[model samples]
Target: MSRTRFKVILYLDETEFSRAAAIYSAILMMNMPNMHLTIVRLKESNQSLLEIDEKCQNIWPTTSDVPQNALDVFLARSKDVQQQVLYSNPNIPDAVTALLAYVNKWAIDLIVMGAGEFSKIKEVIFGSLAYSLQNRSPIPVLLVKELSQDFLEGCNLTPTLTIVPKNQHGN
Candidate 1:
């Protein structure tokens, strides 16, 4: 059977590891041949870089931060990698709406975003974007809280886990 392309959208904003997540996602995407990574940055700023082309190999994806900053990172990558990347910055009024629109438009399989830190009062007043996305997103939403390398190095997930039946009779 042919493997379907797995599209993962890496949502970026003003949060910890937001920039680094792009590089990390790219590296992670490299390992998964069938996976396509699209980096999305929605924050508005004075500077912006808009480069979205399917045939162009040297084009960059859109970013809300300093245009060159995002470009410099991707520019340093090989042409093959650059060509595989597809970027888009939605112009919708609400962030959740914008992200959801892109998700449907791109036929995204998964949505990955950094787990931002927000004060309790702020969350109570404004609400958490991550939480809202998790609740509203049609597909699965993965929240990144730490560097992949750190988490991978610290935890060994290969061990065989024993399964205990939940309906077992009392001993």
Candidate 2:
């Protein structure tokens, strides 16, 4: 069978460390030969996008704070392909809206995101981003606990092997 193209959007924060980790995890978990990855850093202002995208060649930056523009660009660029948006921060409403817009506009097939790191008390009191996404996202969303070095290294393997345990029946 022919390989299908995949366009993945990774929403990153200010720190490059987390972004790097997320990117590495995405490369491993997605494991599509025709995968195109774009890293978008959400900041307080518009300038951060240029700084991150330009200064850091690896990450694709965007200055559009409004959700529609971000989704439009993603959809227009990744036509006739599987599209996904992965965000580390679940509380950011802008990010949520952007992801939703992408799904609506492009009919995105999957969304992969890292689990939020909020306390149960805080989540119960104020609600959690992960919870919101899980409850509201239109398509399938795979929430990863943490991205490890081994997983990143495994991504480089020619034929990646992901073992999923079978049920007791062991079909």
Choose the strongest candidate by TM-score.
Answer: 1
Q: Compared with the true structure, what per-residue lDDT tens digits does model 1 show for residues 60-126?
A: 5656431333344444433323332223334322557667776787798988777766788987787
Candidate 2: global Cα-lDDT?
A: 0.47
Q: Candidate 1's C-alpha lDDT?
A: 0.58
Looking at model 1, residue 112 earns an lDDT score of 76
Please list the C-alpha lDDT of all candidates, in the order they appear: 0.58, 0.47
- Candidate 2, residue 82: Cα displacement in angstroms equals 14
Residue-pair clash count for candidate 1: 0
Number of the top-ranking candidate, with lDDT as the measure: 1
Model 2: per-residue Cα lDDT over 49-152, one tens digit each: 11122444333343332123333333434322222224323345645665566556645556555565678798778875455666788777556556567865
Model 1 TM-score, 2 decimals:
0.57
User: Model 1 residue 138 lDDT?
Assistant: 97
